[model samples]
Target: MAENLNPSRNMCSTNLSLLLILLISSPRPAISRTRVQFLPGFDGPLPFQLETGYYLFSYYWANDNDVRKALNVRKGSIGEWLRCNKSIPYTTEVASSLEYHLNLTTKGYRALVYSGDHDMIVPFMGTQAWIRSLNFSIVDDWRPWLVEGQVTGYTRTYANNLTFATVKGAGHIAPEFKPMECFDMFYRWISYSPL
Candidate 1:
């Protein structure tokens, strides 16, 4: 008698073999449909505030009592009020603003968000938390940023042309604390460079 042959078993085995071969042959990373490029940091003309001697004087000048008087920002006045929310209990409506930032970035507009690592008021951690909620893919992984041969802080760039940076050892007012680093960060950001 001839050996019995099951047609369904043969077909299933053949299909499974073909599927395995296909997967094995294409054992490679899938090419992305959209490519993202990232610039690490700027290596161009330095911003005015970052220039030697200027940053110190400018930072001090901006925070001087004369300027405060001219701006009518007396002690315990609107300037202080604006920095803290203790005077009035309120909720921030920044979610919509964040969405708007993402929308603008998607439309080809660049954005930069920076914070002082040591800031207790409106801390950098909170800022980072909100930024991560935007869900933008990071093109440049976080790394230390350098200025004048010294590490200023860390920086990262996103696919949506958004950059986030931190000013090391700085407070809520990054410029006031780390003026040169802040200047470099802002300069790079405005010039569409990086960091």
Candidate 2:
């Protein structure tokens, strides 16, 4: 419980800790995905600012200012992809983009990409669209586990060796929305990592 109650000034650190927890736990975690909510809303770099809530609910959080600063919240709608990577290229970029990801994923490395179904910040549908474009395939129609309840859903690509999951009642902030499942997924993904 204490671990779940961290303030936003600690959000980034919290993320780092989560990565660590996923690594340390026994039985191993099945999935791990990081949160990116427009730090500076544009800087696309570390040392991101902390000021306003990234979105509507941010105002309701105890660490609103820290969230805003660390998240780099800017004034604009996230219509499609957020372009969060600072190092991604423009030309032959698709080739450059997700290459490290593909490299790690293809060596039988497991990847878990879960989105909060209610998260407009990075919608599940959009994440799926991005996953679809990656075109990772040793085979096709690879499947993953999913619960029919409102809490979660998952789709897998055996061809690409990537799994896309959805948390039903959660929003843009997943651990905040459903910590139990978040930890569950995180623990699983971390167990057998190339990390």
Candidate 3:
């Protein structure tokens, strides 16, 4: 006895098979790569390396739309509004805020300067050196800071109401890498408790 198949089902199957064959046989568009030599508002060819192509496009798409609207900023790209130039290299000498820090310290403003121990971009040693340059006596010497009975990092207090801390095992962005430990550190500092 021959097996019976629904006519509609048979027609659907045939149509799907043909569609798949067409899709598989169709030509794909060629991907072309073009290097960006310069950007608008920048004086010459890009000074630093320019990496193109799509790796993570979502980050580029992210913007503080609400913040811009609240701040009464006209509708424009955030980078343009901020006059940000990605080609410019960030260096300590070029981007030092030490003078402002000194002024704040002299005015008796308490400050917290925290660094990630694993942050090579802005190492803790550099932070220590700058803090020492302020000539503030040590109020609290370097000691282990704890979070939930575990050593989270090290902390030191300066005479000029300044505090320095190292977030242990954290990278450039400590809060992002060690959220709980960073939160505890921030909470303690803001509450005027020892880290």
Candidate 4:
């Protein structure tokens, strides 16, 4: 006796079989976080490589639009950023207020003020001027911090528990430029150990 098969049913079975094969072969997301190797001087084992500053900048801008949208910022033209929003004007009063808060209000809090020695965008001299205006007594005098038996930068601690540090051979992005020193400084500060 000859059996009759439904063409539609056969097609459905074939589709279901293909779907199961795909589902079985696909890679799964990791269940647990993998430990990262702390290689201070080099970037990555990043999932992908960023070759230069231009690449980093491009990545930042490309991602920034999504971030802005998520934050509910008013959208503008495509690929355009709204630089100014007619917000309150900036003045020295703002700087003084921040300085006051840092000097007097944050008694128990630990504050970290850092600069890249090579940063011209916001010069260390200007930062120093403002910090000096705070008049916080120096707990630790300015001295060079050593890494790999060489001077990495200078640091000083203030009576209010604020610390100022400079990263040598660094520019606007100090942490990126000197990852090892930045990590060391961060760890030491967070651990309440000497930096």
Model 3 misplaced stretches (Cα beyond 4 Å): 1-95
TM-score of each: 0.53, 0.43, 0.57, 0.56
Write model 3 residue lDDT over 35-91, tens digit each, in one string.
Answer: 334433235765543333111111221233443454456686345322234676876
Off by over 4 Å in 4: 1-51, 54-100, 103-105
Predicted candidate 2 versus true structure: per-residue lDDT over 1-195, tens digit per residue? 224333544333334333334334525222224343443223355444322233322222323334444455543422222224356566653544577777887787777788887898888888877877777653434344443333354545445457666766778878766776777767666774211
Error of 2 at 137 (Å): 4.1
> lDDT values of the candidates?
0.62, 0.52, 0.65, 0.62
**Which candidate number has the best lDDT?**
3
- Total residue pair clashes for candidate 1: 0
Query: What clash pairs does model 4 have?
Result: none
lDDT of 4 by residue, 161-187 (tens): 889999998776687678889999898
- Please give me the total number of clashing residue pairs in predicted model 3: 0
TM-score attained by model 1: 0.53
lDDT of 1 at 16: 26
